[model samples]
Target: MKEGNGLQIPAGMRDLLPGVACDQRQLESRCTGLFTSWGYQEVITPTLEYLDAITIDTGEEIRDHLFQLFDRQGKILALRPEMTTPIARVVATRLRGAALPLRLCYAANVFRYEEPQAGRQREIAQAGVEMIGAATPLADAEVIALAVEAIKQSGLEDFQISLGQIEIFNGLMEELPLTVEQKSKVRTLVAKKDFVSLEELLNSYGITGAPADRILQLPTLHGGAEVLEQAAWLGVNDRARQGLENLRQVYQALASFGVSDFVALDLGVLRGFDYYTGIVFEGYTVGLGFPICGGGRYDNLLGQLGYPCPATGFALGLDRILLALARTNPPARATSAVYLIGGDDTAAMLNKATQLRSQGLSVEIDVLGRDEASLQAYAQTRGITQVQYCRQGG
Candidate 1:
């Protein structure tokens, strides 16, 4: 690649200009406020963490995405790829003896070294909560319901949360007679929704009939409560049955939370993270191809971090939420009026500007000493409404 003038940001990174940045903050504020109202207190963690600690339970796929650097002592430090691991680290070390069921929340930027796309970026902003120490279905339901509510509160009316349980797939895979590599391949195929490749591969391994059919039908199992009944016969093993039962319990709880209408049963849903032990889900809007939010019950993460505790949580992609809102509802033009004060008397203009600012108004003063016509033109160019002409005596 030819080196040009050094005016370019690295690939997979882009600047959020004034207008877009403001919208992003507003969206994040709405979601974080909602989390606080639900008794979840906010926590902040370092953007860089010990590389070994962060990837302790995240698996090789996530490990490959980390942005790594060496510290002064040659210790490897990495920009956090996700908040869950760091939060888990904190819970195990700092808040270990705080109490059971610690409700924590965070809104922070994480970095990942990956090929960026529409919704995916190298630097991602996430707002999420982790519910530590509760293993009940209600805890799982709380996070899901909160997720639905968070997205709704972000001005996104058209969205759905597809709920799934990792145990369901794990059980089914265990019942099958495939090797570890074969099972991994199946998981990848199912996650990609590549039924054709999955079937071809399964058949190539000489697996067919009911066994193959069940695996193929797994992804198709999606809908209302009735989908659970349809899956009854499929959960021939104890583990699979337990996962289905857990989903049923969580589903009922979601109804009580008044968010069942926004959720659907998607048995094929799979989370990429390896720590998720139970129910998992992803939130999707109408037009966007990627999920605006995702998370699940990682009952084992804290345990792996040396604290044996059950936990459930989620993270919403702030950038993707902004994208979804832009598609559905472009915000009404800045209704919060901005004023530009200009006049013969600098003191009067400054005083007026200060007064307006005190009242929570956005005010700008004409420091250039321009004429009324030029001041008005400047305001018009800058989209500053409500231009005022203050005078020494008027």
Candidate 2:
């Protein structure tokens, strides 16, 4: 039997109480409204998925962070670590022939067995959109535009989306005279932004000349349009060079949407090769070490799942955005319903509540026949603007 820990909840899990819980709901509602306006229909996926499916494309790195259990038949199961893979599976198997360029959005909870921190919840709330079947620069730019708008609409003043293309790194690596294993090690170092160790590692490999120099410089080639221009001149293969060209077009497309101010180039924002194939970006704000939002182009994922399609998407850490908003733009307090005070007229108060509710107002009828003055005081405390007294025989 499970041990009783009544008020003591498990690590990394939390309860969203009255005020903040309401704020979260309001935020989600607002996002849903925004998504609807953008023509992205919402969809809900299962919270539980098979363990093998989750770990397949993502590699074994995620296995340690998964919360797994065995089913009655001994089949392995796990809570969703993320949404993209599950959604990809849905597109592949269930909605195989659905319309192309499906714009699907979701507001849901995902679980990961991670260390609890300020914004890292074991059970996290995420709101995101998947733009599948379109592989053009416009598709990439569209999601970035939506992400920028969502943050701006969320009342966050100071935040930026760091944009980068994975192919640039992959391209530079391909030009190097290193084996696959050696390139993987170098990529890992650059991903962590470990310039010192990366330099030493390059030296250990006896790599000299342009490829080494350009590889070292790739991580630091960030910020503004200069980076893209610099990319055009970087010493790399044609494939990586073509990746930069693609990112340049994306940047130009973003400018047309008038969101260039919210974007910056950071080739260092390496997300990983397992999923994100092309342009990867991260949303960051001052004083927050983690990105509030992240997503990228995955032209290969659907193919891996048996469907051949190009797609781009993003996922916002709703809890992390809430935390940031709390620190900066604190949400408004929740309101209360009209309180009905009863004095031996509970039935009358019920009738009054029904009348008010029918008129599209919230109402709370008294059950214990609380006094008028006391009920009024309670209403005032709960932010209820209106109150009615139902007296007996009146």
Candidate 3:
């Protein structure tokens, strides 16, 4: 290969060097332990999927973020932009006959075509779990509680889980005879926290007084348990009323689990993902610009994949979480690894390296023709703390 001028990696893509990779592995291992303790089984899915297989109404937002290519059969394929859709496909097809209340976990790298920013990237790693076949309020509470515990176990203490019910907006839309276009506009406004636009849209429809007040209050309906009571006092229509009741039930269940301290209700939290059908929530760190973790109930998603099982899951942005933790605590010193240097004693060095690995130590042997000083420099640069010199018949 010939070197070219200004040849460089793409903007949003990044390479994780040895030290950073180790840090990521540690974080992932810790998360896996937490999920396993909660009785979730691990599952692996493919990185590529036929565009049609993962398609959904809310998929338009995701499509713009996907890295798409043409397959050998002239079919469009996309690098997975998220794990939930693929997991839903798996549940709908492969595990369609699995037992009820199936719990699954996964760790994967997802690709997205988006501009990179601090703590954001085109390729990101995530660790997540899905709880399927359980639709009770207690089930929802259990997942949220588990999420809180996972964050705590990840060494992140200053974080909050913002909860929202998609039903609130869905309920309000059900009462008004609005076109799909209007509903979409409302959804967009709500997601962007555009209160002025929301007010204009509501007022333009001839809604005023109590009805208008309640509609505008949608964006601000967030806080603690008190927010739920205020939401109820706003004269919820039949659909909104039902949604509110469901939310109250979820909150009470969470309280019973002793995890209400880390939760807050946010009625205006309309995540950009369209697949979310019910209660939606995201975990946020104060210093980060985006959620470190997100997931929600998608009871209808599996149905789209041919299975009708209800499911809810959450995914932690492993890379972003690591970046945030790095900013706060700095990455711990890389563990010392053993480096074996040899020449004519290559066989001996290799044997010793294998033995060290068997004992659970990272061991690397020099196979190149570099001299001892060069080998020592290489080991030092890689944060290798020990170097063992191996000579034949000595």
Which candidate tops lDDT? 1
lDDT of 3 at 69: 92
Measured by TM-score, the strongest candidate is: 1
RMSD to true structure for each model, in Å: 1.9, 2.2, 2.8
The pairs that clash in candidate 3 are: none
True-vs-predicted CA distance for residue 313, candidate 1, Å: 0.6
Q: Residue 361 CA error for candidate 3 (Å)?
A: 1.7
TM-score of 1: 0.96
lDDT of each: 0.89, 0.85, 0.83
Better of 2 and 3 by TM-score: 2
What would the per-residue lDDT of candidate 1 be over residues 9-108, giving only the tens digit for each residue?
8877889987888888888899889999999999999999999899987877888888899988999999999999999999999998997889999999
By TM-score: ranked, best first = 1, 2, 3
Tens digit of per-residue lDDT, candidate 2, span 120-174: 8799999999998998999999999999998888778899999999888888877
Ranking by lDDT: 1, 2, 3
Residue pairs in collision within model 2 = none
Q: What tens digits encode model 3's per-residue C-alpha lDDT throughout 278-323?
A: 7788899868979999888888888877788888889999998888
